[model samples]
Target: MYAAEEQAKGKPASVPRFSASRRNFLLKTGGISFASALVLAASGCTDNDAPNGGSLTPPNTTAIDLGSGDTGILNYAYALEQLEAAFYTQVIATPYSGISDAEKALLTDIRDHEVAHREFFKTALGSKAIVALKVNFSSINFSDRTSVLGTAKAFEDLGVSAYNGAGHLISSPDYLTLAGKIVSVEARHAAYIRDLITPGSFSSNVDSNGLDISAAPTDVLKTAQTFLTSKLDGSHLPS
Candidate 1:
């Protein structure tokens, strides 16, 4: 939860900064990619165990460690923000040939939201957070409309489930509230993307028991791993 005065610090970056161990963790998890290489080369010794102030360097891999406690929760949000921002940036950069004008507009809004979310965690975390994650979306065929939207829907749904699973682990009421608000929006994105894939797929995929479903971090990260160029260790994050 941003204080009234801090909300004005401008938008946050897509991911949190990292410590030495977390950086090593990301590199181990990240699948090798040209982007990953660039990120690695750029990184150098950053203060470890500081547990405050946002990181100054980009993470060596795509995964976010999140560590423990409220800061970890914020880092989780930051990681999702990076993923969404990366996906949408790619979506906008290489628009599908037959994409409708309306669809493009909606995607743009989604991109903006992701960017804002990314920046929010950065400011909140200040220096303790990991750096912006370097993303590798080469596996995705941006030219194919269905492929792009299908992946987008998966990511959005995963985000909602992830927040639901991890929210309970957060001790801070304010951060938990923020997670709740963000997860609801992610659910909306999931439903909207699902409907786009098929006229009525939204509610169908959503469990009859609830509007949103919870998922352990391992399950959530495993699914997300498909889109990432890095390998992630789910053992450290709250399940």
Candidate 2:
């Protein structure tokens, strides 16, 4: 939970920032390159891991409710992406000790991808988008490679499962399609991070049925709340 002073601040501790070159490119291309052609088509109007269960109601009255239906789902995703983007941004800002050049480059790419994903949801949702989330990463030690990679692995795996679980809840085909694309990218991230931890454990999390594990939104939110200062009310989310 955030302190009263922190809550009154009304801003995330770390907001993802893009380079000027990337910003200029996005402006020139109308963000099609990083966000995809679908973004231009609509202008565009649009649209975790935790335990394998948890309550949907927030822990406190000031919690941010995700609302109901598809819009609620989008907000849920945006919040997670915000958390990911913030985590990676901090990782890059303070490189873990003994970090190799190869590792740094790869992590930087992941950071950029997360930032792009975060921006995409924010743009698509427009007025419907929730406020930027306040993330709590004190548990992570940014100076240690083991700690950094471990957290990265957790976040990536959680993200993949989150999308898999939420897919059915999305009623819009366009939103579903977009979700599919993003999840695939997230899976790739998960695989890469897993391999980094263990040479060939990339697919270790897959089930006996050759499918990745999925968790309900309730479960995901329960775990996600651990790293978030803002309590989330998922009770109104689609069942």
Candidate 3:
């Protein structure tokens, strides 16, 4: 019933619940400890497993592999952040027609926040960070107000769910803490965008249990494909 109403309002649909492979992986690794400060709790892992810092090279074939373990989770997050940062950058660069001054400022703030989040993950991941991603925004009619806000709403909602679903997959307590902080910001973005699309939609995102829905990394990437030119490989991520 809630989903039907939300869909009727043209809001993002809730992700259907799936098996808990990601949840199981989290439980198994939550107790394991890494030997190195930069490596995952799993054996034979190291920071060197990732690309060089500040490298903007996109992978060939347009398919990225989110490797197994905690690094994979971070890469998954970094990928999403890159998409968001690129999106808001374009949004601010070319404001949608009839956009208000207040809206412009708010969008700019969102852009800055996304860029900061993207850079934070990059810095945190260091050598483990994936290369810069290439995005496809051909579907978005950036000049239209409805189109822009709608896309923003979708991205923000997906981000919140992605983080919530991946929460348990994170084995490191410190990393989990950091993710919690970021997800809270993402949730705020979702709420703001939702309200912009429909006044009083802030609560529409909450389920009957008063909890936000979560999506496995794979499922999240499936939706993200709309804006991405590259193919995402979340198969390697813990599942």
Candidate with top lDDT is 2
Candidates in order have lDDT scores of: 0.62, 0.75, 0.72
The residue ranges of model 3 lying beyond 4 angstroms of the native Cα positions read 1-62
lDDT of 3 by residue, 117-221 (tens): 676566556666788888999999999999999999999999999999989877677677767767887887788788888999887988899999898876788
Error of 3 at 123 (Å): 1.3
RMSD of 3: 15.6
Residue lDDT tens for model 1, 153-183: 8788788888988777666555566677667
Tens-place lDDT digits, model 2, residues 98-214:
998877777777787788788877766667788888999999999999999999999998999999999998777777888887888788778878888898898898999999888
Give the winner by lDDT: 1 or 2.
2
Q: For model 3, how many clashes?
A: 0
Best by TM-score: 2
Weakest lDDT window of 10 consecutive positions for candidate 3:
26-35
Ranking according to TM-score, highest score first? 2, 3, 1
Pick by lDDT: 2 or 3, better one: 2
